[model samples]
Target: MWDACPIELARPQKCAISEDRDKLYMDFAAPLVSEDLTLVEADPFQLMVRNGNQTCTIKYTDPSNAILSKENACVFAVNLEQHVESDLILSPTRGCKVLANRNETNLFSLSHCEKHQPHEESHFVQIKPHNKQCHTYCPESNLTFEGVNGKCPNDVWVMPMNTNFKINDVQFNGSRISIVHQETLDHVGSMKANMHLQSSVNWISLMYEINRSQPDFKPLPPFELHDYTHYVSYSFCVVVITALSLIICIVGKKLNNLPQSD
Candidate 1:
């Protein structure tokens, strides 16, 4: 007699896959085996990755898209962080205010009183960038004349005046005059008077007053007198022609008066 034998086999284990690709997929029936697996995620600005017990961070703009891994760390794939808005505003028109004063000799202070009394001018006022100093002139008079003292920087003392002097309308030595204030009557004065300072307070102040009355000031080119080359050439030609005519007249007169031999 022979006995019948029956055997039962084990069923395969079920498997499940994670929705996120960053996670690994495995089946219950699969044997546990150690293998290196890398999970990566990317966005416009940055890249993140996770590997066996490690995390890697990368920038999208990097020249090479090489994978980076941490020595020992955990990785997280997070949404891009929002950047805070800047709180800065710009103005349409921007400008700076400047106070400029011209330095001059025999500089007088003007009174804005209705009577307009002229103060006894003592020391010359020298207004500068940092401070104002009282300078003494040669004669210490209202009509002060500046000379080449050799102490001035340019070897000349510039007389800056807020008076009526039309430097633009005057001409000198093959060059135009470039006065500080040309258009405004308030700053116009005789170039000679300004250079020589031979005018009275009333006259000088009048020029300054006129300039102040004007609303707008437009600079004019200084007067320039150039050499008259054409005139000189004409004169030279006239002299040459006159000399030639004189020689011809003398020769004609000698020929006419020649002695006749019979």
Candidate 2:
């Protein structure tokens, strides 16, 4: 009947890639969710964290073929999707700044993609280190202390006995903290619920998550410590001592001027 129509071939065309190396990605920390919800599982979507060892892809190929619609398909409506997860894999040990992973020798030597550590040419003793003020200290024992909400690092439990609404028996178990809810002043052991904890490092976190809406939950300000030592401001303390001394002097003089009895 008829010889097959002449075979047709599509020509190969190279994708044009243009890149500006100036752009860079930065770090972000999402706010921690509340304790009422538990994160049984994460998205399982691995996102890359950028650091000094890697550079942005100075080049990428734009895919050749573009799909278009019969109507409303124009240059303005076009969106290009690329495989952005592609990245260079560096050794787990290389360019790591973590103190445990890399020792002082390595950490101190790291440039952090900068030119060099400050005063690299000078002796270590010559550099003055940063000084931070300590909120708590013991002069007798020569011990320096750091704390949050007036609680020492060793005693970090948050007790909620004094709130307008009360939370009871806050207990930690298996990546969760559970507490009872009560409206009255006295502690109640009846109601209990758990909140999810996302992560922790050196410090304990108060931020947590719960499964359902926790209407009773409210974030409170940092604990206010009391001055049990009967502390007065320096100026007021000085004034009180001076007044007492004057009164004592006057009374002693009056008594001494009187008859010299036993």
Residue-pair clash count for candidate 1: 16
Give lDDT tens digits, candidate 1, residues 1-262. Answer: 3212111222346656678757765543322211221122221222222222222222222111111112222222222233212311121122211211223221232322122223321222222211111122211123312321222121112333322211122211212324444332311222222322211223354345444444464557887655787788889999999999999999999999999889
Give the winner by lDDT.
1
- Number of clashes recorded per candidate: 16, 12
Per-residue lDDT of candidate 2, residues 5-112 (tens digit) = 222322334443346755554434333322222111111111111123321111112212122111221111112344223421111212211113111111011112
Model 2: residue 250 alpha-carbon error in angstroms = 5.8
Q: Model 1, which residues run further than 4 Å from truth?
A: 1-124, 129-243, 249-262
Q: Provide TM-scores for the models.
A: 0.14, 0.16
How high is the lDDT of residue 33 in model 1? Answer: 17
